[model samples]
Target: MIGVLVTFTQNEKFDRSTLAGIASELRGPFEGMAGLRFKSFMLDEDGVQARNFYVWDDEEKGRSFFTKELVDKVTGVYGVPPTIEYLDIVGFVDNSGT
Candidate 1:
């Protein structure tokens, strides 16, 4: 699978409520996309950083979504640019005993 890690610093005066709203809007669309397996988000207000872990079925699918259109849309919502790293998962350990 392919994974994407995104890290970003929020604008100092950014509104938390707006950030929450944007995140909420994104969940549905991301979950509905083909090849998107899962996503996890982490926010550190004290550190002024946010991270997103995204798992996709393959590299192509992940790359397609990182186009200018998507970046522009995301930047518009966050009011700050993000740095993203795309990676290929060679191994994993799932301990969920379901």
Candidate 2:
């Protein structure tokens, strides 16, 4: 698996409620997204940043998803550019099922 960390930092603070709403609206589309194992939307209101974490089945799909277009699109949404980091998934734990 490949782990991806996408961080969006804004000069202005973001509303927690608004971020939650966005996450709620976006959940359905990502629930069964291909090549995506898991995804999380995280917010740091005090820090004025939102971090999105993703786990992909492979590096190719993960890297391919973060194209220039994606960055531009998200910059428009978040009002700032993002920093993307990809890392080898050394270990993972899922306790959803016994």
Candidate 3:
């Protein structure tokens, strides 16, 4: 499995509504996408940054998704380029569902 983290930093603090819109817009493209296991939309405690954590079936899927077009889309939405990091999933624990 592959884990990907993409972070966006803004010059000024972002509002909740804006964050909601961003997350909402992203949901359509990623949810149920092939080779994508999960994605979490997040805002930093300080509210100046936003991030998306992703778990993919493999590195190929992760790389395919985080492309130049994605960078353009993110920049268009949030007005900043994202810093993307990819990692190998070592381990995890999930108990959200019964």
Candidate 4:
């Protein structure tokens, strides 16, 4: 499986309402995409940063969604650049269902 870990800082003016709107717009389409297993996102208000954890069936599937257009749109919203990292994981723990 492939994993994507993206970390970025939000603009000082970034608001929760705007973040919620963006998340709402992306949730459905992303979840429905082929080979997309799951996604988890979190924001650190004090640190003014955000992180996204995504699991995909393969590299192709992950790359298919992280296209330039999507990246541009997301960065535009944040008004800041992002640092993303891709990883290959050996295993994962699903504590939520337990």
Best by lDDT: 2
The model with the greater TM-score, 1 or 4, is 1
Cα displacement (angstroms), candidate 3, residue 28, comes to 1.8
| lDDT of all predictions | 0.77, 0.88, 0.88, 0.76
Predicted candidate 1 versus true structure: per-residue lDDT over 1-98, tens digit per residue: 89998777865644556657767887887777899877876677664776778988878988787888877777776767888899989986666655
lDDT of 2 by residue, 16-84 (tens): 887788788879988888999999999974869898999999889999999999899878877789999
What is the Cα-based TM-score of model 3?
A: 0.91
lDDT value for candidate 1? 0.77
Steric collisions counted per model? 0, 0, 0, 0
Q: Once model 4 is optimally superposed onto the true structure by TM-score, how far is the C-alpha of residue 60 displaced, in angstroms?
A: 2.0
Candidate 3 has its poorest 10 consecutive residues by lDDT at 89-98
Look at candidate 4 and tell me the lDDT of residue 38. Answer: 86
* Clash-forming residue pairs, model 3: none
The TM-score that candidate 2 achieves is 0.89
Q: What is the lDDT of residue 3 in candidate 3?
A: 94
How well is each residue in 1-98 modelled by candidate 4, as lDDT tens digits?
A: 88998777855635666666767777887767688888876677665776778999888888677888878876886667677789997988868787
- Candidate 2 vs candidate 3: the lDDT winner is 2
Question: Model 3 off-target regions past 4 Å?
Answer: none
Q: TM-score per candidate, in order?
A: 0.80, 0.89, 0.91, 0.78
Q: How far off is residue 40 in model 1, in Å?
A: 1.9
Best by TM-score: 3
